[model samples]
Target: MRIELVQLENIRSHVKSTVPFTRGFNCLVGGLGCGKSSVLYAIDFALFGDPLGRSYNYLLREDAETGKVTVQFSQNGKSYTISRGLKRRGKGISQDFDQLKLLEGEKLVASVKSEAVAEQLKAITGLDKDVFREIVWVRQERLKELLDAKPRERQKRLDELFGLSDYEKAWSNLAGYQREYEGEKRAYEKDPDVIGMEKLNMEYNQTAEEFSRLEIELQGIAKKLEEARKTLEEADLKLKELEEIRNLTEELKRKEAQLQVNLTNIEDASAGLAGKIEEKKNLIENFKQRLSTAENRLNPTRLGSRK
Candidate 1:
């Protein structure tokens, strides 16, 4: 987790101070009592709320009724902002629940509760107050004290600070683990399934052989299926060809019927034309015969018009 910025309002010696921090190691080099350490305290408060054994009077400004700290940080590529505020009651200072908020970017993830914000910050940064105090933020005075301490106390303190005591407790808890393991091993050996291993192995082998036989049969069936598919494809092609031939035959039949109708019409037209021509020839012959008769009966020399 990297702290990007810290804003302190009425916190200790700071009054509306905005301190920007870089990614890597940052040093707050200022003269004593310049509120440099107050910034660190405010950041801690913003992230984890109040630390144990620390008084609110040390954090809240002398006469200020309200104090707030906002910390903007980034963890695992995700940015977060957490704010915590303290309000002075009649005799005791309490958390300003209204100003408490944990935000991811612009979205409020937790609000109005110190426990909720602390839990969210712990989940986000993977560090609780204890871890932050002991490992991440070692106090300058405590370091000197640790160096000046006796060997055994120093070692014990170091173990507790580095979380080595948890390992010691875990090792102590494993005292009966070996006995439990032995008992479980004995029970496993006495299991009926373990005693029947040979029979199970023989059955497995027989089943494997049967599976191989079935696999071969499946391959034969697949081959037959492939041949059937090929036959169906060939049948489909022949059916298509037959359909085309049937269409052509039908067209030819229709054309033949049309030609027959045309031939009958031509024959009827020819017979009518022949009849008309014979009638015309007969009329001409009749007219000629009448003319010849008239010529034979009439005189050719003189006329009898006056008599």
Candidate 2:
């Protein structure tokens, strides 16, 4: 893998910087405090995010709200671009917001947040942060530390560099499994059941008897469960019928109340009608008495006029 371009914004001392590299031999030649190391750190930030041992806040520029790093690299003839960003949480505080994206040409392939982004970057590059820092981009100080390491530590580092760590881990796991197997074998040999076939047969008969008794008990329990289920179903059905009866009773009561109201209204109307009929009868009797008096007076007047 070769880095083609690195872009940094508000990262360390770099406000905005772009560094490009050629195909073969490329070196960053600059004086002290000229951001040469910051460029490399920015590349590391783009690939693997913040270093595990160091605080992420140190990567941010002073008084900057956000920082970003973008790296374009070529691996196996395919070009990939990775971008990462961080936002400050408060004044003089580390950024809480971290995001990363992996793109092939113009198409986005992976977008991850925080720690997952580092994992995805490792998967894409086939090198973790520590391995990349130690083997691919070893600083002068780190190289000195490597030289000064003990023999065992040096061998461990060599194993990591050559990808032999996985094999060492596999061998270690195999030894552990072998020890476990041996221990199990010893335990089996000491077991009383391993003494003779007669003892084994007796134990087998006892286990079979116990299993048979348990099976019988399980069958009884199954029957009880079925019976309980049927009883529950019956109870549910009865509850439904009771609910239906309760609804019908409420309907009947409402209808009875309406019928009582209608009866009261009819009785009131009948009483008023009877009182009007009695008044009409009294008026008719008074008119009949006035007519009889008028006829008697007229008959007397006619007889006097004839004389």
Candidate 3:
């Protein structure tokens, strides 16, 4: 993994710093206590988070309440950024897990999870903390010691760095594992199950036949269930139709009752109108009789007076 940039905020002697690195062999050349090593520490913290022999208090600036480190790097032609933070807690400083993040380009890969970031970084860079410290980021003082060391010691360290030791250890452990496996194999060979292999196969076949028969029965039951479901659906539809007819019948009954009431009211109104007509006819007949009497009396008076 190639580091492209390292950013620091309130880290050690630097209050704020942004150091950009190029593609190949970039070195930090500064006087003593010039915050050059602080940048390296920040990069490491950003990658692996508070490694062994380092603490949040060491990375965080003295008297500073908070600190942050952001590292941008590229591996296998894919860019990634790792950000981590530290905060003072009471008398001690601790990682601000809320600020832990790993991003690929603008896409977030991990957030607020140190373990997730470490795993992703391991996968991307193919370097764990040990390999990074031993091989990738060798200290200036440790460089002389590594160079002046014996060939055997140097080779051993390099083997550990390259993970050859793990393979060697696995090879060494395989002898014991093989012995255990052989013992278990012998025990398994003498077991009743292994001895009755042919009988077990026959039983398995019988069980398989029984399962097939059951499956056929289940299919038949499923067919019946489907037919029953269809019949139930038809019954429900018929029930709905009957309910609609019942509602219509009740509505017709209500209308018939209202029509009967209206017919009674019309009959009562017709009887009252007939009674008024009869009274008017009687009054007319009485007025005609009075008028006829008055005419007859006037005619007689006229005749007598004239005679």
Candidate 4:
């Protein structure tokens, strides 16, 4: 799938920038440290979720990450808009996935991810993180190095042309089958007259019975193999889902801890505020008492102040 366009805001080296890329030969013409590569990584991360980092700060620009990065782009004629934020207050990143509708020629081709507004983009795209990186996109410099390689230096190039190294496997099975058939034919030739013919008939009937029994066993084995594969797949999915749930639970605990810290801060702030308020109230009362004292002193016992 080809990504046709991308729009990034608040990403590294881009405070608020909207850049439209072409479907072919789009070069980010800029000097070093101007965030040329950052744009590429951001585009890959937004469209495919193949970010080059294990953490939130891995691919993002320096001194950033307090704010969010909004990315809008189109892939394989379908458009997508995603807004992601790794706020300073939280341990996990907040993600939003949006499916876009666009007209392809005269018909409207809707994006398939419209069903879930909030999910891992992997769920929306039906692509795992590794597959997206391998099939859809590649880094610019790595592409150049891969192209300049010799045939012998690369390991997998030869395997693609020729089949697997265990190429005699099917041939070996066929040879064994031929040997068994020849032995059966020679055994039939070793018999003689009408009595021998009767014996041969008995042997044929017995072989047919054994063949039918083996066929049933093979069928059962095949069914069990299919079930085994399905069970393996289910187990893998369950493991991944459990991992995600664990991560989410950890995040929830972090949020709860932060909330408790905030409550404590509010309590301390409230106590300080109360003390300041009472101090100001006492100051006003003192001012009034002093004024009354001065007036009595001026009148020489009008209000009975101490002489």
TM-score, per-candidate, Cα-based: 0.68, 0.50, 0.52, 0.37
List, residue by residue over 139-159, the lDDT tens digit for candidate 1: 888768878899999888878
In model 4, the worst 10-residue window by lDDT is 94-103
Q: CA shift at 291, candidate 2, in angstroms?
A: 99
Candidate 2 — which pairs collide? none
Query: Candidates sorted by lDDT, descending order?
Result: 3, 1, 2, 4
- Evaluated at residue 266, the lDDT of candidate 3 is 93
Higher-ranked by lDDT: 1 or 4: 1
Tens-digit lDDT string for candidate 4 (34-71): 87876766765555443465555555445554434445
Instruction: Give the candidate number with the greatest TM-score.
Output: 1
Which residue runs of candidate 3 sit more than 4 Å off their true CA positions? Answer: 165-307
**CA lDDT for candidate 1:** 0.87
Q: At residue 125, give the lDDT of candidate 3.
A: 85
Model 4 CA deviation exceeding 4 Å by range = 61-77, 90-128, 140-307
Each candidate: what lDDT? 0.87, 0.83, 0.89, 0.62
Model 1 compared with the native: what TM-score?
A: 0.68
Q: Give the RMSD in angstroms, all C-alphas superposed, for model 2.
A: 14.4
**Clashing pairs in model 3?**
none
